[model samples]
Target: MISLIAADEVPQPAYSSGVMLLIAAVAVGALLFLIMKVKLHAFVALVLISLLTAIAAGIPLGDIPAAMAEGFNTTLGSVALLVGFGVMLGRLLEVSGGAQILADTLVTRFGEKRAPLALGVAALLFGIPIFFDAGLVVFLPIILTVARRFGGSVLLYALPAAGAFAAMHAMIPPHPGPVAAAEALKGNIGLTLVVGLPLAVITWYVGSYLVSQFLGKRFHVDVPDVLFGEVNDGNDEDEKAVLRQPSFAVVLMLLLLPFALIASNTVVATLGASGAIDAEAGWAEFLVLIGQTPVALLLTVLASVAVLVRPGRMAEAQSLMDGALGPICAIILITGAGGMFGGVLRASGIGAAMTESLGDLGLPLLLQAFVIATALRVAQGSATVALTTTAGLIAAAAAEANLSDLRLVLLVIAIAAGSTVLSHVNDSGFWLVSRFFQMDEKTTLKTWTVMETTIGLTAFALAAVLWPLG
Candidate 1:
């Protein structure tokens, strides 16, 4: 029933299980070694390897292009706009000094003694409408500022804040990782959002905030001077960009708007499904229509711009929105390539191969999702790629496995959590965190790596605990 993934479309494989497995291993190994050792661009490596994987799997050569295109187009159809709007919103907030305002407000509310927690809380709030990389970029100045004034390990503030972004991005919809996974699995996106937000917050608190405070003491890191003095860094421009600082309430409202709309949609759908509301009623139709994640997020972006823009500077706001799309183009394309690779693997019978070997073991569906996602994440270094790929691989099995809708959604969460594990040298995020905090490889491994692993495991554990209840 999956779009573009009919069972009848899958070609009969000529390769033995051992050969198919070998091809799979070689495909993944080549992808990693090229991206890491040979220094190939990730987008190129993913696309090239996907085409090769299709050929090796014995698909007719002419059908290969269609397979890749279906995967790429399907993934981008859901992911591109959410990311586009989200990044635009983030750019506006960052360029307008709203991020600084938000951070300062957080510190004021929490007081200096608990400033680390405050920055983390701010990041958590700011992170809802933002991706990890973009959110961290905006928050870096504030994190550095807090670290400078407070005089302690940068990790004290940085880890919790960064971890908060990571947690939200990994678990929540409109972040692409979980969303693409849900799409591939044909699970309920609205239900995932409704169910996911609470779980994300709980897991972030236990996995990121508490764990961060522990690791903060052990791994002391000095805030780097990199962004402090650079003219183009926007540290100076951002301060004078705004006529007056935006109120914390305004920022908070914008961040929460999308979630509220998405939640309302989920609520209405649940009520209608349970016969609390007439499914055919106009109210139900309206709620479900506006409540779709893309529509909600898009509306949020539009509403934020209206509220956040200085009256005479609509043009500048327009520029910020336009500027936002360019930086994320690479990210969007790479994410599609990941989806393409996953599609190829699916067409090749990797999922069936796995089911044949492991399905008889009676591993809980949630555990299997986590294990597969974690392996792909560690091997490849892209969480979105790992997530989308794993979801595609397991899509057929998920359909045939007799899982409920809610369980399928939770399975997506489990996959997302798995994708968050063990960010090492292979991951760009590892280097991003390391360079930003001025930590060497060893320290980054000790600190950032540990925090990432904790977030993934904790999120997965929480999802597992919730599965039976579902």
Candidate 2:
């Protein structure tokens, strides 16, 4: 029957449980050491470790190549297209002035007095369709300008935006992490998004605003010279020309279209099952199928290129594509490698052993998720790694736990929370914040690390509450 192992039971492969666990730990540790200490590319490190794992577990020589190939091809097949299209979409938005338009529109509506709220909204809205790092770089100049004008800490504005981005980036589907988690756990993407949106709002306000308020007061440091280096003095004609432009309503609609379609499809499908709507309608089925995550993202990207690109903006569009693709290449490779790592673990029976060990501990699924995610997050600096690894470990456990769909969704959030905790020297996000804001390691630890922990803990608490209700 080619049965996958359940969480409560360990599969008996050719190797002993102890031997499998030991080999898995060593493989994971080697990958971490190579990546974090030796500065190897995560993709290479993962592939190397996958082979080492196969060897240590005595996986047949012939099967190893097939396993690696299958893992790589399967993951890239599902995700590479969406990621490539998504990168292009984000680039078009950036070059077409869509991001600036959204930022300016929010600032105008909210006024200078509520810039934080505006920044948060901007992050939430724009972040949905773009990578968090891309979103940050695209809008950093405006965020800096707002901070300079407001006479407060830049993080007073920046942190809220970051929080919103983090929440959506981790929690929502179509994003690589959430999408990977949904696929791994076999959960419904639409329901995950429906719950994730509200949770994201709560996390942003509480984690970003409240935490930043205290951190900003305690740090009270000036913006570093590196960050404010030779500010353009407001006379750059080209830069000025791009500001306050683009159609706000059109950009907003484009951003929301995919999400609205997906959400509406889920609602209709659910209600249809309860006899609230006709499930057999051609339009209903079409909407549901089109709203599938991959299709929606593809459609959005195509529509964005058509709507956002002006006739003369080819150079701008090219630049945006270059910029977006440059950063995403690393992410795409790492994510693909992580997928292979998971697949190798499954093939090696490590996932089954880990699930059995956790079941033996009698831990709640939420707590199990938290521990697994937090452990991986501490070991590796990548949240994507933590989320993917934890999801793989818990997939069996979740099924054995017989969790409701809502509880399974909450488990995804819990894994996100655990992955978010304690970002420090090992974490790249810490360094990114430190470099961009020109903070010393210590200050970055105090602000960015704490902010991440706050987001993680807040998300965990919310997940805990929601888990029981589910």
Candidate 3:
């Protein structure tokens, strides 16, 4: 005879014990050292480490491949479409002269005296819709032009722009890194935006000001020949070649539309869940459906075409599309690989094991999120990798802890802050800044690297303070 029991009373499988947790921690640390110190590609390094983690946990070898496959597919399925669309949209903005228009208008409005602040604002706005590399290339020419005309240190303008762009690229959603983190953590996109935007603003201000003050004194140095050759002095030919700037309204509208849609969807979903909206029959379902993607890319492209494609600019569109793909491809691949890593960790039960162990320590989830993200960022140079990896680890913990949506969103921002800190030789952004601004390694380290670290640290500090309020 069998006895019936309450559904909630059913026994669940036991998690890894404390000893297994310690082993997992050691494995994670070893993986980081091998990748960072030994110089392995993170994709290969993470997979190898994950397999070792499973084996050390006494999981059978035959199951490793299955775990990896699950991890790869799950992450790709969630993010692939959004990434592809984002790339295409960024290409449109670049080709359409939208970024150029915004830069030109800001520089003109601010003049040389205040150009640094203006450039920083332009970058903060422009970077939201475009990739960092694309923004760099699109605007670097202008930075050179401004420096030549104004006689100020290139760092004054360049660092502000780079800081702003990096801040937004790392923190904003609809960009692959933050979006992936948010998805993995099941975070509320609206709250992430609200929390991240202020942090981004503060980061840009502090980073730009410091870069200007410190590096502005070193303006006497010669511009590198490579960048010097590309500088234009605004001749008639140069003026003729200049694309017409897109209207500020059009550009701002395109950039904000997707964010608005996503935010609306999140708000609706939250309200519906809380019974603030009628769930059985209301606008909430539609909002949730539309919010599942970054539909704003489509609107952005259309706005670009409407505002930028005057008679002869069709060729420019094709050129922009071709150019944008090359830089974006690397980020896409890295993000996909990160997804695979996260999946493998989950399938192998490593994420769960790590979470269980960490939970026993009684650390607040917010602090744990930031620390993991920062450690990974410091270990590997990629913010996306750090955000995605941290999100995966946090997801495992969130499942056990039953963390709220608001807290999860805060965790995503905290991870973003971590992934953003400490740019150096290993980071591509460092090279981009060094080359574009004609700065030597020392200057680049002093200005660009420090500025990035400032942005990261500032943003993280803000997130830390806000975590409790949430």
Best by lDDT: 1
Predictions in order: lDDT: 0.72, 0.67, 0.60
Give a tens-digit lDDT track for model 2, residues 107-196. Answer: 687887688777778778866655555455445545665665556677787778777777777777656677667667878767888998
Ranking by lDDT: 1, 2, 3
Where does candidate 3 have its weakest 10-residue lDDT segment? 1-10
- lDDT at 231, model 1: 15
* TM-score of every model versus the real structure: 0.66, 0.62, 0.56
Report the C-alpha lDDT of model 1 over 131-165, residue by residue, as the tens digit.
Answer: 67656754665676667666778898899899988
C-alpha lDDT of residue 24 in model 3: 48
Q: What is the lDDT of candidate 2?
A: 0.67
Error of 1 at 36 (Å): 1.6
| lDDT at 236, model 1 | 57
What is the alpha-carbon lDDT of model 1 when measured against the actual structure? 0.72
In terms of TM-score, which candidate is stronger, 1 or 3?
A: 1
Q: Per-residue lDDT for 271 in model 1?
A: 74
Ranking according to TM-score, highest score first: 1, 2, 3
Residue 169, model 3: lDDT of: 82
